[model samples]
Target: MTSPYRVLRSDREDPTVLRRELRRRTFPNPGLAERVRAILQRVETKGDQALVELTAELDRIALTPSELCRTEAPEPPAAPVRKTLRWSLGNVRRFARASRPRDWRMRNREGAWVGERFLPLDRIGVYVPGGTAPLISTAIMTIPFAREAGVREIVAVSPPPIHPVLYYALRIAGATEVYAVGGAQAVAALAYGTESIRPVDKIFGPGNAYVVEAKRQLFGLVAIDLLPGPSEVAVVADEGARAEFVAADLLAQAEHGSSSRILLLTPSAKMLEMVLSRIEEEIETLPRRSMVESVLRDNALFVLTRSLEEALDLVGEFAPEHLSLAVRHPRSAAKRVRHCGAIYLGDYSAVAAGDFLAGPSHTLPTGGSARAFDGLRMDHFFHRTSLVEYTRSAIARVEPKIALFAEIEGLAAHGRSASVRVAGRGRHKENGPFLRGRPPSAKVR
Candidate 1:
């Protein structure tokens, strides 16, 4: 029988081919972009009407403009769900609170006080994907941090047939408003605003390709958390790692979607064989077997490397969203990982821990974006404004130098403005506009 997953040997496969294979994971789709653009345009032009129409068409759930905004709060979740959500929220909040940066001021050598003032955004929009799954954990990961940052308005949007559990989770996580909307249309509404839903300052959370494309296109219009694509993971294991644990980690990431990428890099071929066998067996028992198989067919890989060093090099090149170090001295191995968005150390530390119970937000940068972007955090909700203060003495000390510098830059009025400030007067006839030019009478001479 054919192997369930492709096996690439570093000693045999060309490095260029390896890179090309990885690049396929992030290949651009014009069709997806065009579709997302249309949705965005429709929502931008038609407002709430477009949202209603698109939600019904795409999600197969009829909704009117009035129904866009959920009117009543959902009842509290059952004990088990509430308990888990509350626990997750507490962990996220505690971590966020501890990690949040503080506003600080320091006097410079010239006696000017300079500092950054961190202020919470007035409002933000959080997208919870209810299509394939409700993603209640997304609510816990996103909203609580906004709340901890003191965001005043937390607007939550998700597609129809939204699980009751999601509603309760949002409420528990401090969502001030909830709406029945999803996909690119929902992102557009949050970005541009509608008759009912006021535009938010920034939008957070993750979604499918359309949603990621929407965020990428609408980034400048409204502040965005990050352009996160499909979910992915890379596991760097060794002979010491358990095949079952490694197989489970790979399967966990694989079930995310067909577009998801899963990789296993190890020095031991035995470890690789064991993981592959375990995956084939365990995948048969999973509810999302088709999804796991779809990803495993093309996107997933089991790489055999000559050494651990080569495995780490492959990891840096991949720059996956979640990385698992299932080897002896996992912590030391983890230290070599410089690019992954999140690292799961040791066989005991499952990616699921970071996904659900871990304090850190599970919404991470994907599709090689982990090289530059960080996982969602509390600071994402706050805007930093720099504060500067200079006394008259401080201004006087630098005025002549400022004038000279402005003169050299050919801005006569810039020099004049500084000179006038030193003179303690407003703009006089001698000083023209901000640009360098002749005085009122000197022109035409």
Candidate 2:
């Protein structure tokens, strides 16, 4: 019988062909993009009506504008579940606080007061995936960062029939408003506000292809977090690594959905065989066995490398969202991987830990986007503005350089704008070049 997953051997296959197979398509399907474009256009033009119609058509759940924003709060989960959620929220909050950017000022060589100030967006939206899974962890992973950043209004949206646990998580994570909407329509409503839902300054969280495409289409209309779509994991394990642990991690990611990508890179053929066997045994026990099986058969790949180093090199090419280093000296091996969204070191460090309980936000770039984008962070909720204040003396010092640049760029007004401040104006004791005492004409010109 043929194996469920395709196996590529470095000794047998061409490296270029293997790499081509490993590389994920960076662009969305044109057909998918067109469909998402229609949804976005509908939402942009029709507002709440489009949202209601699309929600019914796509999600198969009818909703009215009045029912879009859920008014009543959901009862908290059971004690044990609530305790676990609190534990996870606490870790996420601490991480957000610790990782938040700080405002700082420093004098440049010309002694200009230059710095950056980060301010939280006044309002933002968080999209939680409610299909296949409630994704309660998504709320904890996304919203606390905005709350910790001091965002005043946090809007959370999920599909209809939102799970009680997920609703509870969203409220606990600091969403001021909750909406019963999902898919591209929810993203469109977030980007282009409806009658009830006001537009957010930025949007966060992850979703399926339609949602990711919607974010991509609406990027300039509203600030967007990185494109974190689907789930992906690449495990690099050696003969010394536990096959059970490696197989479990692969299956865990596969359980996310059929679109999820799973990869196993091993130098030892015996290790590869063992992991495949373990996956077959373990997958039978999973409740989402069909989904996991579909991912394993279609989206999974097993690569046999000449060495662990070769496997690591392939990992860089793949740029997986989550990387597991299940090998001897996992930490040292992790140091060599530069492109993955997140890394789990050692056999005991399951990717599920990072997905659910880990302090870091699991809203990470997917579909090879890890090559360019980073996982969502607390700072993503804040907008950064560069602060520049140049004194008359500082302006004088840089005027010649500015004049030269203006001359090169053929913008005489640009040079004059700088030179006018220093050229014959009386030296004032004010801190900035343009101050309250400056004439309106001087300030304008």
> Best candidate per lDDT, number?
2
Instruction: Tell me model 1's lDDT, rounded to 2 decimals.
Output: 0.86
Candidate 2: count of backbone clashes, pairs at least 3 residues apart or interchain: 0
Candidate 1 regions with alpha-carbon error over 4 angstroms:
23-28, 417-445
Q: Please write out the lDDT profile of model 1 over residues 1-445, one tens digit for every residue.
A: 2475688888898898886665434555899889999999999999999998998788888988998888686888668877888889889999999989777665565555566778999999999999768899999989999999999999999988678898888888899999999999999999999998999999999998888889989998999998777888999999999999999999999888888889889999889888889988898899998888999997888889999988988897788999999988988887787888999888899999999978999999888878788999878999999876666555667888888899899998888776666678543333212212322222221
Q: Residue 298 in model 1: shift from native, Å?
A: 1.4
- Candidate 2 lDDT over 45-87, as tens digits, reads 9999998998889888888889999879679879999999999
TM-scores for candidates 1 onward, in order: 0.91, 0.94
Per-residue lDDT of 372 in model 2: 84
**Candidate 1 worst ten-residue window by lDDT:** 436-445
Stretches of candidate 2 off by over 4 Å are 430-445
Residue 122 displacement (Å), model 2: 0.9
